[model samples]
Target: MNETGIPDDPLLLGIDTGGTYTDAVLFCERSGVVAKAKALTTRHDLAEGIAGAVDAVLAKASAPARRIGLVSMSTTLATNALVEGQGGRVALVMIGFSETDLTQAGLRNALRSDPVLFLPGGHDVHGNETPLEMERLEAEIAALAQDVTAFAVCAYFAVRNPAHEIAVRDFIRARTDLPVTMSHELSAQLGGPRRALTTLLNARLIALIDRLVLASDRFLETRGIRAPLMVVRGDGALVSAEFARRRPIETILSGPAASLVGARYLTGLDRAIVSDIGGTTTDIAVLENGQPRIDPQGASVGGHRTMVEALAMRTFGLGGDSEVTIEEGGLSGRIVLGPRRLVPLSLAAHLHGGRIVEALQKQETRPVPSRLNGRFACLSGMPARHATGLSKSEAALYARLGPEPVALDALILSSAQLAPLDRLVARGLVSLIGFTPSDAAHVLGRQTGWDAEAARLGAALFARRRDGAGQQLATDAEAFCERVMARLARRSAEAVLETALCEDGLDGAALAGHELMRRALDGEQSVTRLRVSLDRPVIGLGASAPLHYAGLGALLRGDCVLPEDADVANAIGAVVGRVGVRSEAHIGQPQEGVYRVQVAEELRDFPDEEEALAFAESVLMRDLHDRARQAGADQAELHVTRDIRAVDVDGSRRFLEARVVAQASGRPRMTLNHD
Candidate 1:
């Protein structure tokens, strides 16, 4: 037993992989965080970063790897991929919809150049099916299998009857080794195109997420940590790693959701606003009554609204490593932070040593400042298979690139080559190394441990650029860096206020920039002083939160709480989360005294309403209980909720539709003994 009177033999290990850093934490239920460590995230080989963080934390706590009872992880890889428009190429098979339906739910835009196959087969609201064209699918399946990594199948009204979707999924699985995703398996909602969009995204992310989970599993086995692995879902619930692999789209906001859970656990706050800043994105959400608010409509990421249930998190492309760009055609030379992340010059120098620094120095010596100054590009270390569909120009430029960073000036001779380079970066085959908030932080001494001299040189080169009026942007490098930091804080404040406003059902994007709102945020003092503030305190969670959010309270007119160990909050949340699974059934009346119940892939007819409802509740309860267990829960408890729609006719109640939902929840199972 430890000093806290709690058994110390079994500890919990939590891991969180973000865009830039991978964090690990050791925790005891009674003692809280015991030790935590962070390592630069190695995208090329995630296992390296995972091992580094885990080893460091284990060494810090002086604990044996076998002591860990449970292992849980939350990752931002799926989220970042969707945000940055990078993923494996997959084919979408639309079983019922027409070419026009592709225009719905932004499905066409999401598909990009990927292939889509349409067949005539679907079901109606009454669970009646249209004849499927099997021959068309059979004829093209072989050709489609040649280039695609996976497949997504969506059938019309699949929520009411999934037979067609199931048939398509089974056929694809039997014919190919690749994974297949079905829309009905993901959501019970009735929107066919949106469901298809979600499934396509899940299909695209399967290989990526599978790799991460497999790597973690292998690493844990090697370390002798004989514990069940759990992954955080977007709604702050935990699920088995296997479950997450099948529906990675559900993990779009996994890291942010985990951080919200951790903030509540650490601060014990019943109501607050949580903003977590990572390397690539800032996620803002609200917590009420000690729980994150689930979005009723569904989780929206990268402008694609999905049917996956998740926390109401608003993600912005503003973070420490966000690319810093100058607004074009502006006399003020206003600086803009990203919707894209870049390899910070300071970090690139730290990793590559003298080469990065020497290149920056050389760039600073050039008399004429160019738009490409202080910019470099390197291969992103993705496997060559991902580069299959690249254009000829992109292929040629990619052939010239290597693992090492090369200055943009040396790589591109004319403006025509810039677009190809950008295309390569967008495909995740390449990474851009340039000035970012991290570099600015290094220049201002707000951050350290990186190559600050390189940051200074990059800042100098950027500061010398002429604005629209042909004037230098800043008097000195330090002054320009200070401006960058100020802009970060300002953007952070806007993000927080925007989330709060949206939660209040206001038009956040419009109201957040209104003249009055701007005046209030700026603390304008005139005949009438305007002020804006959040009703609840802001809980800042991130490694860079302390450095960037110091002055946020005054801007928002509310207290900002930076909890202890906030740097590792996501990791902490990963271990403390509970496993939960929910199953739902719907009962509808086609005629008088005839009831139909739809549960998953099964559609049943009942003569009595009570009997239908009872059967649905029973089936859901049983299924959810088993699902909870499979999702890494032990001794789960089940609860049922019913929402019945009816109308009064002649003073008699008439049933329209009834929805039954069963939820199973329990603490994640842990290994009691490791041998």
Candidate 2:
């Protein structure tokens, strides 16, 4: 489709489903971005956020939902389900390997919650194996009916020879008709347990994403939008809803990736670190060659370590809503939110009836005497406080709240069982961490001409904290933010290391060494789909309100453009996605004779060379078609690979071997069920 063919003034929706908020944006096809909005993330029903944001953006644009011709959504639903331990119950059926295989690399931890089921069937690396007992497996399945909501079947060497795995899957389908994930169907990696772990997590995540997509569909319907819906993927590409359901893991980093893509599209630059600080976290991504850097190992969800492909991004918990507590003069008061974010009732101030200095004055009225009672406050260099008269309670509170356990993580994640009083207490802290609407406005630079002082004062009030808290607190806010950033950088580097190099040989000490991660970050040189684009300018989008935008645009230090409707970038992003299908099949020989491999796709051959190659090509195309069909793809375009290897035994003879893997991707409108 021609870009100009789209409506000049039409609204294109982009939606970003983050860990904390679902933001939406409306971009004018003619003038660029037009409007934006956000809604509280509805964990109970994701659609709530989507609908809320969409309506808000529509209102902002003074347009109707029917005016939108395209819609796209980027979600962390699949990824979050895995990470938050909220996926449906799942069964891991290992066809050939035993439970013993799970002992390596803490594999046991990966499969901890999964119900492990062993079947008497498996194949060798070459696909040859002892046949499984159909009757016995059927009986086992019959009994397993009550145990799990989904099934993940991983046959030994299934990718090598999928016949047994296929047969078992067919059997399970015939019996239960449940959602089933096959190892060969998911990836082509070599590790059995790791591969199995990937499949299991995928299957488990299915239960949650199915609902997420359904909710999203319903939300679009409410807006009167009936466009062929697609979801943005982690690779900065797009895929169909049906495809998303089967491989939800791919969407783990969808939100951040979409922003990176938008950034590149806006500035047309690459090779810079994109730092997006939101309400709950700060996402740092490196762009190379106009793309986000994809984590080679793929980030882990919860702890499953699924290969949900995504750009390498560092997520820091320090956000608009982080907890803050100041132990002062032996008196401890938590800001609850964060040193930066200030809502109403900053912890220490909240404890003083929402007044700014109640907690500190209480210390002043105390009978006890301490050295801090007379300490002078220093900005660059000035007297701040004197702790000499701190009371016993206040002093002990200071010692206990001396900083360490940041309160933000706990307040936002309030549990149901916590009493209202406790929740209130937690919320006071959360508000301090969470940015208020005014603070948000200030950060986004929207409040520039209006009232900067008012915004800062409002921030102080909502946060229940005064500027002086920094003087009395153990550490300054800027230093605290830096500390959070450093930790995030370290963690992100470690995740990247595992992907750049295999984790098999790393020892405990090596894993813990910060220097090792630093070295890895410095040495990376290869290019992957997830590239960070620092070459071109980065375009920043979001509703930081007033605070983040000013210093932020400067920090970006490049040609940074904000969408006219930056707040709802997600809604526009949601509408920019597409449906895609991919198929892969490997053909090889493990032993001397019978040379064969698996085939996928609908075409009768290996694409261009198939008719010439005849049988081999035909088989190759079928597997690709098969996978496309399964992925709900209508037609497929193939990008095939043929890997030829020459192997020599240590002592003597050399042999030539060819391993063929064929892949095809296509939109899902034509033969949507080809796979």
Candidate 3:
């Protein structure tokens, strides 16, 4: 295996699963990134994409998979699930919550059409035990288990005392094989409804994350790779596959966090703005003192706030594969970049070569512009099981879809059918092919990875579209592509600036389009000329960063740094990061002299505050250390912090509550024998 004369130190395999691409990198400890490659992500069977990228990178490096010491991955699957409103159907068991509480924290919306069962068992804020009732749960548990893929048990004051949640979870596990998530395991916050929401989302994501892990594992096993597997968490830390599976909600921003870590590792910059542009979204975050700041107010994805700790990244639905649409009424006929991702016409053509080209060719002979000119529809290759629960119309439309790309015009019979098509797409059961920045790049000769001829044809179809004045938008494909490229650059600059302003405590949404911002970005030179620039350099990451961010420096009047291996930064970061686990315990006084300490599962009473605080710290340290080790850490380093709250009574301070927090971190454990 060492016949190639390379270093004997073990090589790490890093993979990043993104919306449009799956990237793989071979990294060495002594050297840096040895080799990297990418493959189009196969939404139908993600494992196929992983195998493709892994095989390509391994072949490029001429390395044996058996010699790999570690395989770590970072993914945007969870984030995308939240964004697109797609995941496994799960039932939420709300304990001690009235129906009215469902309105709080968007819990009801998060549940969607999922079944919810309200029970009477829960604990009070002071850990006061409530009467336990299992009659309702016993009556419905069997039937509910048969319907949903998983269950979420969220009891009121679960963070204060998880006894009720634990009971419900145990009961569900005894009766069903479905996974269960407890609210207390996710967050220790006082917001019961918010915690419930997080738990429900976590339960929904269980099957999705499990599939990803199992897919990767099966692929590795068949390839004879025996490395320890790890996954990147939302906070840019590595965790064991098992740990990640249980708390998939914590991986909401896993890909973005990995990119930030990669940005720092690649540039060695202490302070800068890191922007990672992917196929479906652009994530922007600030780096200060060699580390990115964590969002104190939990991570918010697709408008739902969850108690996931992650980098304070601002994600925008603007990327290479973002759907391109027209704003017809504007005088200039503004081109809008997406809030929705579409299969790039170039990529779609590559997938179904003759069908796509033939359809586009036929579209050119039309006398008038058709709304569905460049659009194609096809099944997403999802399992037949995913197609369940669809409405009659949706099912009918879905059944007609096949492997080949069908022109949208030919697929739908009427305009009324469009809503069903959208619903199918939202459910991840179907895909839409249309013009995107990637297709525009291909038309302009900026990219050539896919079917350039198909891109050319798709661009031409869009070019014939009529604007507000009923005039042709452009003379040809190349001319139309130029506008698309310009629009992307302008939007990317605006997104970065808006994130900066928002971080500076301003209304960035409004300021992004303000006169001053426009003047600064445009470099306007007039009387009362206004100027603004980023305080720090921008570190651009992602596979398309180099291609798209080349002009960002001039636009922002700031330095834009695109590292040499920026394309594979997320994968690189996935392998280089360390395992981190956090554990917390609470100490509160139920009476003037009696104190109660809430550890992982035990609630013990203490006679004094000092005794309670000491016990809490010990419990947190042990829990975090064990958890970190289980998460793939070896000889982990540990730290602790205590926050004790007190109240002033009659000019004298009195003990209120004390919180003990512990953190453990270390590099992921590697195998002793690479062979």
Candidate 4:
């Protein structure tokens, strides 16, 4: 309200980059969404997709870039990295950890042949430790630095006191130019191996997240949109881009969390089950009391559990681009969706023009369908260095492949060559293009963004496939496509019910596959009638939610809410959240009246418990306040909570330990134009 009581425009731009598409929306405080736009995600150069979406949204809203006061983004890049098992290779440095500890928390499996260095220095439960053997680290530091892109340091009982981990981090920093992640910085939990695993993951993600942030920043600057950039955390909270760059592990579920936030805001529902389907995964979570349920056990992504607080989401690798495969060994063959995403044949055709269609048509001329009738393989957008560990056979086959899609039937010379190709696909160096739900949608006329003729040909090839009893699966291409859609629907319903049953304290897999539950879900008619339903409504979110979740209501026996602007829900959620920063301090009593408080990096002893607690709280509050402000929050509000553990001894309470947590939260500050 300058001189005439008129409020200046304060527009906000939100962007979400998923595995398949990038969505953008323009929003305002006075009004809701002004406009929304989408573009295909370009893996080779993400900034291209960001520019396309942002430019289109701005043009649609007819708003000047200068009027945009804030720009925030959410992405599945970290989550996808975990799922696809692709990231910068890093070495894990373990202090005082035995080989047996590797078996705990799937640490050994997560390491997956990565270099691990074990040393003989760490603290005990009381944060009392032996002196670190700096000479041991020094001997191997130079050689290890050359092989790994980053380093993860974790010492036993580092949460109680991170002195050893800090020393190792400094040691590595001075020796190498690589980034180093300390376990204590990621989590204050007591589990050493789990914390190490989390630290390793964070170290792996540093480069990926940094690239995304830099790309977004560059695009914003290029467009002359000089707003403060923000990034969403896994718990549906906002943080500054700089903060996110440091702790990218907190963003593993950033996109799904944003969808949940968007779901609640769009439907105004206090309690419901929110399910968001993307190209690679289907994320399902419960919303209670207008907030998403937080997982007490930390977030588990791609089978690895990290100490990052996130929504209690059950994610299944079932989505639009999920690779379609036939269930083996059954006379009546069944279709199965994926744990891996594949480019649809129709999409491949559209991308490569007539080459893809010519190959498919040429294969159709055969008397019978080959094993790889509708499958093709191509190199993904990874760098050449990523193809380092290929075996002789794998290397020979890979060398023959070019950038264009090659029909699998034409590429694989013998049966033994198939395994090598699968390995390449698993390594993310290559992608297998095949029949998927998206191709089925194109065949059934439900989608039209790609080549429909190629979809029809692919569907015809799949329809020609024989079951164990040697019978045609479908009468025609359209019928076969319908079966694909039905298979996806049934699997999706099971995924939802499985999650619900788990929440109800039942074995999700067993209950979901039980005969009784199956009858109830299908509404079967028999002498014994059974009915199963969800207690809360189901909120569907995603670009294809309306198309895929149309029958979800009947399956769950609840109202299926698909709010308007569902396609851009993640983008909307990215902008509507407030910035939050939390800090904690642990206070313990080492002896009678001798209190020790673990501050940021050091432990100090005080004469009494009150003095220690006060000092710790003051430090934490000041640190959290500064962080929240630096995280783009203005006029932040601070709250403090203390969890003091004590037991009644005779007549008085005996103090054991105390944890002080400080949280600072505020709406993001908007940049005003100075014209």
Candidate 5:
């Protein structure tokens, strides 16, 4: 048995649901990975893909369902949704704030027409309460409940005292069935607008994460795997599925964090730059002394900076399935890859074989290529109910779309139709299918498992497009495919370098594109030869890492390590991770000799500074220990740290404030025997 007292080789199942694929791995601590499998992710019904991968892995390992002791999963679904600006609508309730406050922290931009209400309620820095006005909320609760999937409550200075926020949350729960997220529950920091923004996002993701957890639970039950299901948080720590459902915003970098953990475990690397290339986004982070760095400023995804504590990772929108576009009005016709993803033509043809092939073949035979030669649109398989809030134009365009792919040239006869089509795509009701890096890989034979014929045809169509100089973009299909692959490599290198430069406190974005940096990357020779390189190797992880990162080492002037089973690293990390929880309390002096201690929704006054500090630490430890258990830890060990602030006045020390933090960490509880 291991030190935790469980069996040494208990079989564990790990699952990772990503933008394009769902992967599963069966692992044993004593034996390492037993079996691994992958399946195309089905967004409409995630269970389909989950079952496909899990069943495949189980069959490959020759293991019965009941033998599994634990099941853990990590996902990029929440991250992708925010990056793509797709989620259920939500209502924001801000107490003790005005319309002017929404302008802070990009909160107004993030709201984007979603309902927001401001009321008179809040607390001071020393936990003094402000009268809460809830008459307006009570009157409009029923109407708001009908329009939004969830609600977010943020009382000004809620971190000082959560009484107002809790009161509003309870009121909402008593009136409506929708989930309500309180800002204080998300963060104890004193930034009201930022905390509210975080709570707003968490509210938006409630239904999405809940659906995934519910689906996973039902699927596992059907398979007779009665193991405790855990979820990987953005910090690479494990938490109960229920915990994740309430705070899905914390899962923004879940998949990338898991990949970092898996990379460290697989390569045993002390320090390396890890880049994980997935279909929708490429996640990059650094491992310092075998640990991923935590972002003290909170995680940022899409364009909104949030208050979610996640790994210090940069997510770029350049990946295998990134949309391939040619820069307009440029004589050289330089290619541009996405900040947006597309369903690759190869995968489309593989799924809808004859029809996809016929469409591409017909497009290839055209005398002159149109701008929309190889583009198609189809339903994204989201349920019809989610198609609400569409404009008349959007509804009309959405009506014409069905399960089958429709060529954009035929579907969009006028330029006016383009905007509606884009709106539909943004709403997640439709997906655009086009030639992407994945199709380029297929054409060049660097990747497989999809229709190469469709890729070749799509490449041919793209090659025939004209540049500003009236010359063809490429001589032939293979040449165009090669150029596409080369661009992907160059972009991937820049992404890695940009991340490294940022970590060193430089302007990574601007420097990565600077002429000197460009020359260094391209190995340009001149009278003044320049060179730049990384101090350590780069660990590349992803299904297509081998193909995409083949030349990354030479470009970066460093070694690139591609470990075995790197493709399923996220899943592996999910199973091997431990559960960790943290709680904090603060002691602030409202006046001389009066210490006000605030922790876990309670505030009390103490005459002595030492007494207040002791009370804060005790409260923090008790709260964190219970939280650790609820987060899935079997038996957590607790640690406390103190940060006291004071100033010397007249050669005597005066107390200002004290912050006490408690941390609990332990392995997840595993089943000892089949029930």
Candidate 6:
């Protein structure tokens, strides 16, 4: 798309992996975005999704993948695996730390099993530990020769010296040739158990990530995309294919990061609330300085908590696919929505001239698939009956549905609700299946979702005149519509308040005010004022933002910043993020009856302390730079930060400690990468 002849500048291809789809983009230095495409995500073979996106985009641009210089991929595989608990067989290897240390915050009860192997050898606050316990360590390595996919070693104070951790690592490499990760290698942070958990998570995700990258690289190859691949991390940084595989956990928030990228590209507004609408859900984030706000608590995957820094984005189940239901006693529908993922039940319900889920509930309850069942603690509070009329597929999916009581809650945590619920009808779960997400979108008078009959049914259903109810209908459809809207308004307002800020102090009024302030002053809303009541204007985003948000925006009195390509917001956002990484190390000592400290790099064995520090600094800095460059960073910088902590241990005062933490970042590589 560039006017320049032969376009000498590198054309970066960016790929973002999302829950539902994989998005690809061709970007240039000066010409901005050239082409983009989206493909449904493949949970089984992730590369297929990337390949689909690549082929679609290249087909549009009439370009070959080989011509692209570099490829950067930001994915949700690690995040999803953790969130979904789908990572393959992995073992946790804890060193020199107690079982008590394993139960620390961020990762409590998340490990599949208790860690194996306990050694007496570990460093003190200063990386100086009792002499090595080589004999015991060798025996431990010998013991783990079989099952483990990889190894993670977290010693008492490896961050200080890493000698013990590295030596043990060397022993691991010599014995098993398995992927080895040491606490000191990843980050120099304290908390042996927390560090061990991070390593365990990384090890667990290795194979999955390797497959993802390999699949991605191969897919590009099929499309003649011979460029090297880069992957995005949770911290909004890019790492090499090799690096990302070893640390897949870093790229879990790739979807939101990409959206942040798109937001940056279109509006150029750094401070604002960026709302990304997907077919199934809405993702909201506060961006300060052109990036999504980073959560102070760190990245949370599935229920397992990890300290991978990421944008502070809040996700909600409220999306286009959210179903609207009415209760029998109420003048209108009870307006049941999610905490559970639906499969276009609304569309299916509409086509059947009834609520499919409700109807199914009326008929019988069944278990959903293993994939889905575990996510929800309970279904919609409905009791399950024997499998009866359902097929294995249907039953499996249903068993996963949990009890009817927990349905909405489960939906909130997953993507099932946003699925084409009408698919249920197609599969004959319901007597008369209806429209899908596509169908509902069209019927709702939106731009996306191409179900024609669905559109008709939705319009008629919402209008309350569908199915030829005629004059015989119990009540006018308009009255029903009004009632439904009233309930929906209340639910939407409540959801927004609860999600944005927790209950208590964060009332609807406060939320409305915050929303208004965030949107108007911070450029989050198209409307200048927040709606005090449901009657006020409300803004919206997603595949249908262009078609639907305007009216809502007016209601909420806020401005809307639609992406240049609003339809593929999630995909675009997936590809629009930066690749980054963070690491920290610590050491402690007590000076003259007082705890005084210094924290630094592990390679302090050099003759000059400054030189050792500088070299160690260079090690991480250059690693980050090289990592950034391999993915095509014209320029990059290393941000090295140091913190000193003085803690009261016992009574004595000696070299109590020192600690160092650093992060290196570079320009996001451009490449159509998937996985």
lDDT of each: 0.91, 0.54, 0.90, 0.88, 0.91, 0.55
Quote the lDDT for 508 in model 4: 94
Q: Number of clashes in model 2?
A: 131
Question: By lDDT, highest first, what's the ranking?
Answer: 5, 1, 3, 4, 6, 2
Best by lDDT: 5
Candidate 1 lDDT tens digits, 15-83: 999889999999988778889999999987888999999999988888878778999999887887887
At residue 62, candidate 4 shows an lDDT of 74
Over 4 Å off in model 5, which ranges?
Answer: 1-8, 84-91, 112-115, 137-148, 174-177
Report how far off residue 35 is in candidate 4 (Å): 1.8
- Model 4 over residues 1-675: C-alpha lDDT tens digits? 433222466889999988888999998777788899999887766778888899999888777788889998898889878977878889999998989999999899889878998888898777789677767678888988888989999999888889999889888888889999999888888899899999999999999999989978888887888889999999999998988888899998999999998898899999998989888788999998999988999999978998999999888899999998888888887888897899988889999999889988998899988878989998887788878878999998789787899999889989999999999888878878988899999988898889999889998988888999999888888998999898888888888999998998889988898889889988999999999889899998898889899999998788999999999999999999989888888888877887888867878889878898899888988888888988889789999898989999999989999999888999998895555
> Which numbered prediction scores highest in TM-score against the true structure?
3
Which is the better candidate, 2 or 6, if ranked by TM-score? 6
Cα error, residue 316 of model 5, in Å, equals 1.4
Q: Per-residue alpha-carbon lDDT of model 6 for 1-675, expressed as tens digits?
A: 333332546667777766556787776666667788888666556787788887887777666555687787767677667765555555555556666776686444666563466676776665557666667656566656676677767677676566677777787787787887666656555667767777778777888888887777777666666676776666555667887776676777777666666666666676656666554456666666666567766677677556567777666665544544433344423345443344443433333343334433422234321222211122222223323466555555555553232233333345644343234333323222222233344534444433344344332343332222233212443344344443333444444444445313355345554545444423444445433322112223455466434433443344555656655544444444455555544433322433222233333343333444455556656566665566445466668865543455588432434445566555654444323
Q: Give the least accurate 10-residue stretch of model 6, judged by summed lDDT.
A: 369-378
TM-score of 5: 0.95
Q: TM-score of each candidate? A: 0.94, 0.68, 0.95, 0.94, 0.95, 0.73
Clashes found in each candidate (C-alpha, N, C closer than 3 A): 0, 131, 0, 0, 0, 104
Ranked by lDDT, the better of candidates 3 and 6 is 3
Per-model C-alpha RMSD: 2.6, 11.4, 2.0, 2.7, 2.8, 9.1
Please, what are the lDDT tens digits per residue for candidate 2 over residues 205-228? 887888888877887786677654
Tens digits of lDDT, candidate 5, 264-293: 999999999999998988999999999999
TM-score of 4: 0.94
Model 2 worst lDDT run, 10 consecutive residues? 374-383
